[model samples]
Target: MDKYKQSLSTSTRPFSQPFCRRLMKPRINYKNISLISRFISQRGKILSRRVNKFTLKQQQLITIAIKQARILSLLPFIKFDII
Candidate 1:
């Protein structure tokens, strides 16, 4: 039992590391299409905070940036594969 418990603990990884190690200072920019795209899914939907592992404030910033980019047509509203 002790050996099993030790092995289980050793095999498990910690969630201490965040998805974004270095966030952009101030806020995420709408004009930065590339950066905004990273937070979007292949289908053009914004990814969730859990997936990005960003704080509430960071997530809100990202959402605003994405929306602004979409409004400017810098980023696509929906991605479509060209056949």
Candidate 2:
């Protein structure tokens, strides 16, 4: 009778008892965090490489275009005074 009253006086978990055992357990997985870091690194690499490639290409094209325009504009001004 005393044991029965002791159990009754305590506050039991919402899950009664069995499920509470699993709920109170501590479990961990490190692979998920590693995967998150890998994803961010991969994305950063892709973006930086693309930006660098485009900048180089744009600089080359602009230089070539300006040289061509200068040659075209100056061609008619040259005089071959060969007597």
Candidate number achieving the greatest TM-score relative to the actual structure: 1
Candidate 1, 7-53: lDDT as tens digits: 98884643333535365644478988877888999899999987886
Q: What's the TM-score of every candidate structure?
A: 0.70, 0.24
Question: What TM-score, to 2 decimals, does candidate 2 have?
Answer: 0.24
Distance from true location, Cα of 13 in model 2, Å: 56
Name the best candidate (by lDDT): 1
Candidate 1 pairs with clashing backbones: none
Off by over 4 Å in 2: 1-54, 74-83
Error of 2 at 28 (Å): 56
lDDT of each: 0.80, 0.33
